[model samples]
Target: MNLAELSQLDGPSSELLYNFGLQPVSNRFLSGNCQNSAPTFSLELRINRDSGLIHLGKAFPVDELKPRYSWLTCFEPEDHLDAMVKTIINLPGVDKDSVFGAYSFKDDSTLQRLDYLGYTKQWRIDPEQDLGISDPCANVETYQAVFTPTVAQQICQNHGAADVIIVRHVVEHANNLSGFLESIRALIKPNGYIVWELPDCERALEVGDCTTVWEEHVFYFTTFTFKLLLESAGFSIVHYESVPYPLENSIVAIVQEGKGQNNPNFSDSRIVQEEIDRAYRFVDTIKFRRHAIRNKLENFRENVGRIALFGAGHLSVAFLSTLGLCDLIDFVVDDNPNKKGTRMPVGNLAIKGSEALYSEKVRLCLLGINPRNQSKVIAKHSLFEEQGGQFASIFPGSEVYLEHIS
Candidate 1:
């Protein structure tokens, strides 16, 4: 669909960049065979012309689609938490004795890092205890559901408002983005600051990484759009930095409650148009890569008997679903014991431990883990390579074995 056609959904100022078609939930790894009956949702990315903010269109209800939590922040996608804690402590008003509050389990590692640095007073929201969830995991929902002003006030009443709130990698998953930011105000003292960290989508949008769009992630933010969103929400950006990685950069920002000025850059017609053009290019690149990668995988499957994808994380799920490559892949390999013996949603492809790579006699396994871990994976599986088995990166332009596809 064209931009004009998509603009009708939200407003004239909002235009759809790309529709990922219908996709299954990313984190659902089931023990039974239920892929055929799995639910799907339309995953479309759009841009707000006036604000230059890119977010998903028609996001599924969080309560209905939330999957069982298997990921732990301490594991993957290195956030450099030690450096982040030092940075937060060095902020003007923050110190080792500052009262800290965290929103979700994703902040566990950061909270741990803070403790290691001698931060005395800290608390994290417990779904079972704080929210009085009888069985939190029975009907899963995004943590943002309880991230309300009322809940924040109650927390403050119980223990004083925090001096610094560390929210790591949870904001982007928020469906009600504005309300989530507003709730932070109620949770912190007037003079308190917030430590925010999220995935930076600037490089992903420029490179058109189809794997960037996860069903749970409702918003995609570049550094420019992120600053714009935070400022528009009445928070001043005290400090900002981008931590670089392979697929995307991690955005670290210190913000405080205050009157924020709208970024003047968004008002410039040239800058707004450039954002629109970048989005258009991103859509075009996805279309091209989807077709090219599918063809390459098909040809490889025809020539090579067995092929598997390494890493059963959301990135791999997005790559498989977006490119319609699930049927081409034999199975998925992950090192996580929790994922083993489970099946990926939509394809019902069995998720086996890394040992399957050798026992199954797989050839040409596509690397789906983070780019930073690529070398470690190769080095760990050197025996696979020694026997003439090849490993290819799903990332475009960063191909190792299957360079022709990228």
Candidate 2:
């Protein structure tokens, strides 16, 4: 059947499964190879209800299952499917012998042809593009390489004299985390250390930040789970700290090579479980707050004449999706030339440049950026304010009105 037919058939069931924490499989075009002569195939992703065990059909194309260039490969690709399955089997609520089925597409089939998967398009950063800040570690050896655990091992091997290899933002969405950790262990000399920096899911849970669970970020690491994971990977944690960053939580883990033994005494599974429990409680408390916020936005939409959303980052997409603000806003405005004219992620809203601010019909601009960029955003649009433009800020759980500058 065509994509429309398949979507219609699967949509309700998919929603039902997803709401229950089970990931229902869907047929999607392979990344980059969508235009290939062979017909695109469907993948059956069976997620265990309790353990998050993800399994796939054996016939799934290797490239499509684990696109080397795609972030999903690093996050939870088929290569890590076995590990996910193992984890799921160890969970409380799983039927070990359940059989799953797979489906295929043929040239003669009535299904509508889909273009190759757009995985590469998601993070295709231009090499020459500047992000307004000089490289902080410009003097440090610039390593032009892929971000993988094996790559981390190689870095340690190449820099033999280095005592510690600090990896910032490298282990966020790792699929084969066990393998990656093993590689890191292999590279470390006796007494050598490895530092991993990642997002703290505990903080995100405390703040009721649903945006933390996006497609790009598949795993949420609580301190306990993180510690357990590290120990399992053969690293003894020297230090662990949680930092406060509004947009993204931070965790710094210092690990050192040990006496070739996995220490079960350091396992913090109970601590991780407690943090998860706290997260669930926090989520429950925010339900009413979220409802109130939605009501307020709906009221504003009914009263406001012309509204435009400013910012096209992930936050904007999450706001639009979570708050159901698509019909309320006219268009999205962004400073990034790359995102301009492209559809916003998840929300699929058409993105426009800052020039959209000049439109006389737009009475208000809703800022969807993080607080750090608030002042710069206001300053950049200062000229527009002189002509009676209004501004507002939309954060995760709150919205505030700003005065129009002369």
lDDT of 1 by residue, 227-344 (tens): 7676666677798999988778899999887654443334567766777788888889888877877788888778865789999888898988997889988999987877788788
lDDT of 2: 0.45
Worst 10 residues of 1 by lDDT: 1-10
Candidate 1 segments exceeding 4 Å error: 1-12, 32-36, 69-76, 136-141, 259-265, 397-406
Clashing pairs in 1: none
Per-model TM against the reference? 0.90, 0.58
RMSD of each: 3.8, 16.6
44-147 in candidate 2: lDDT tens per residue? Answer: 22222222112121222223323222121121112222332243233232232221110111110111111121111111111123112133322101122222
